[model samples]
Target: MLRFFFVLSMITTASVSTSGLAQSSSVQTAVDKNFLELETAVVEAGATPIASIDHARLAKAEGVEMPASRVLIFSDPEINTPILEENVRAGLDLPFRVLSFDQDDRPQIAYTDSQFLKVRHGLNDTQALNTFESKLLEVLNGLDAAPAPTSELFADYGVIELRSQRSVPEAVERLSTAVMGQDDTVWFGEIDFATEASQQGVALPDTVLLLFGGPAPGGVAMAGFPAIGLDAFCQKLLVYANEEGGSVVIFNDIAALAELHYGSSAEPHHGLNKRLTSTFRTAIE
Candidate 1:
């Protein structure tokens, strides 16, 4: 648990996004079966269904009826707390959900990948989060006869360590400028984590999470892979006082994160892979 934090930090104000239950485009159609069987099985699998949304009835009430669209939200404090305890923004992905609906009169159930949280929340290491996802998927698989969605996928995110020859603020300023120069859509946000700690009388070095992202690729990234929303918007730069008395700059590996979430298609959609590769070099150096 603490291992993942080395990169994401204590997870407070810097929080933004994480898409739990990464959905697969492959699950295009619903299965012709009883939704109750799935529901009961989900409970038996150890995850509680906290809420259910009947989209068809709700839409019908508005006089614009639709198919049998139902959404089930799950709650497992054991599965959710590890993420929420670190960053509250993760609540968006919480109550973890599963959607069951009549698509063309066939019933379909969907589950998202938890790894999305690791990328978006700034978790440096993903082993713990990936493990939880695997457990959740195994439980869910027991509920449905069909195969459960892919839960465990390795995303090799690269973190560049640039030994800043200047002051912390100066290095951040240069990096921010370079990120923006590459593309105006790339913007930045900064949080003074170390300053907050010093206020509590705790001795600490200068530490900050320099967050950045813009519309150029973000909108396109999500447009291609809606799931990438969790990974894209949260791109950032981490600067802290190193033991050597100088500051070290760390940032999310765009290519690694994009490929992880979008999988193979990431290379062509708006040329994300190529763009990210160039940016990594530009942003870090």
Candidate 2:
């Protein structure tokens, strides 16, 4: 039995917008549970655990050494459906994830703060967001973990967007092919927001999300700070239809994200960022 201690840090005063929302975007929590234990807790809380990524194992396979780190992607449609109806962009951040990593020999867990999601997505449904927050808290509390003092690990969300002359579907297919064409890249899966919304009787513009990453760059990034895997390991590209019927493609800026997690934008990150930019640009063009 492996025992891990996670420090849960909730940002109470971090504000992303000047609208007085008074919410932060990220939270780190401490708990006495391992990765599997945490996954079970998520399922017991009635949320669906979609994927679990072991960053340490991936690094090992790539001949890189890193501390133990993993990320679990899960979702609760009941809590997210309403929010999605309000803002479909939230799909990029949805299927909530919790990261477990060993830092300084002390294991820790962190997750995206729902209140921050509310502001990030411009969601107006307070009740739905509150419910989402409570449901996450329920999972943590179920582990019998206590909250600790907050930390300043929060950073501004950064993404690069590209306009596509093609339609959303065609752009998504092209982007998928482009990503897979890259050396060492892996296409995890895609989420179609428009299809999901249509099933729920809500109309939304064509929106699709593509998740892909390679151990070479991703492992290299995590070798610096394993926690970065929570956000940067699984690279995401969101393709959506614009008002003009064309498509727009967006993805996380690796340089900005690397700086946010590793405290500086190193040369490796710059190279990776350029590579990603070129790949997306080629697909859309």
Candidate 3:
């Protein structure tokens, strides 16, 4: 019994050490990279970093504030402005609402937009949603309006996906650091991922921040589902970004939302195809 316990204790110690090392490594690497340009812009706008953002005006609909999770839906597919469409297609999904909460798990604000809401009614799988999310974030995270596509060899990203297995809070911090740079002017809205779950009537915790931005020039559009209907969305976000200099739109529970809309009775695949084709033409046209 003594021998067995000794072995077990050694194993436990090693495991703890490994876990700590991994976490420390993650933090160190994250600290080295740049991310959230929009958030930095908002702060540089001379507004308090934690100012009470007008979520209603930003999101264009009614939104609610909840604990660490909030959901804001963009329902309208047609109301997308040219800039919004390009940006959305470029991977800036037109955020329509924001839900903010406090560290004590208290509700803060629920803001929504009428013009931005458009029922997805499509996209049923995590794979599809992942592809969509990856494409959009690539553009938003770009230091320039046109950041090059990621390479597959990148530790956390490739041509289309930028994922970090780090904790949600940590990932957000890293992204925020990258974004809040000198001369970066923008605003941001925060919504909890749990808000998305609640909206879908499910229970899930996926931290996602939907970013919107100010306009300087129109960016190029890529192909695939990300390309579809994105022009409209991007146009809206860019306009918002240009006028306000930045916006913080939040999202949680991306998987649940993808499943809800994609699994619905509507022809999800067809919708995706149509959107993709339309995006291609819009970009070229």
Best by TM-score: 2
* Per-residue alpha-carbon lDDT of candidate 2 for residues 1-285, written as tens digits (9 for 90 to 100): 011122221223343674322211221223224666878888889887666666666655767766667777776766666777787667667767777776655577777667556655667788988898888787776443322111322322566778978999899888888888877775566777677667777778898877667776787866666666776768877788889989988777766665655567767667777888898888888
Give candidate 2's whole-model lDDT.
Answer: 0.68
Q: After TM-score superposition, what is the CA distance of residue 143 in candidate 1 from its true location, in Å?
A: 21
lDDT of 3 at 121: 17
Residue 82 displacement in candidate 3 (angstroms): 28
Candidate 1: lDDT of 38? 55
Q: Against the correct fold, how does model 3 do in TM-score?
A: 0.27
Q: What are the RMSD figures for all models against the true structure?
A: 13.2, 11.2, 22.9
Locate the minimum summed-lDDT window of 10 residues in model 3. Answer: 1-10
TM-score of each: 0.43, 0.80, 0.27
Q: For candidate 3, lDDT tens digit of each residue in 1-285?
A: 000000000101223357645653343223222222334433443222322232212222223221122222332122222222323222233333232222222223222212122212122334434443343343334332221121211221111122333454555444444433313223334334334434545433333443422211111111111111122122221111222222232221222222332222224333433443343223222
> Residue 156 error for model 1, in Å?
7.4
Instruction: Give the lDDT ranking, best first.
Output: 2, 1, 3
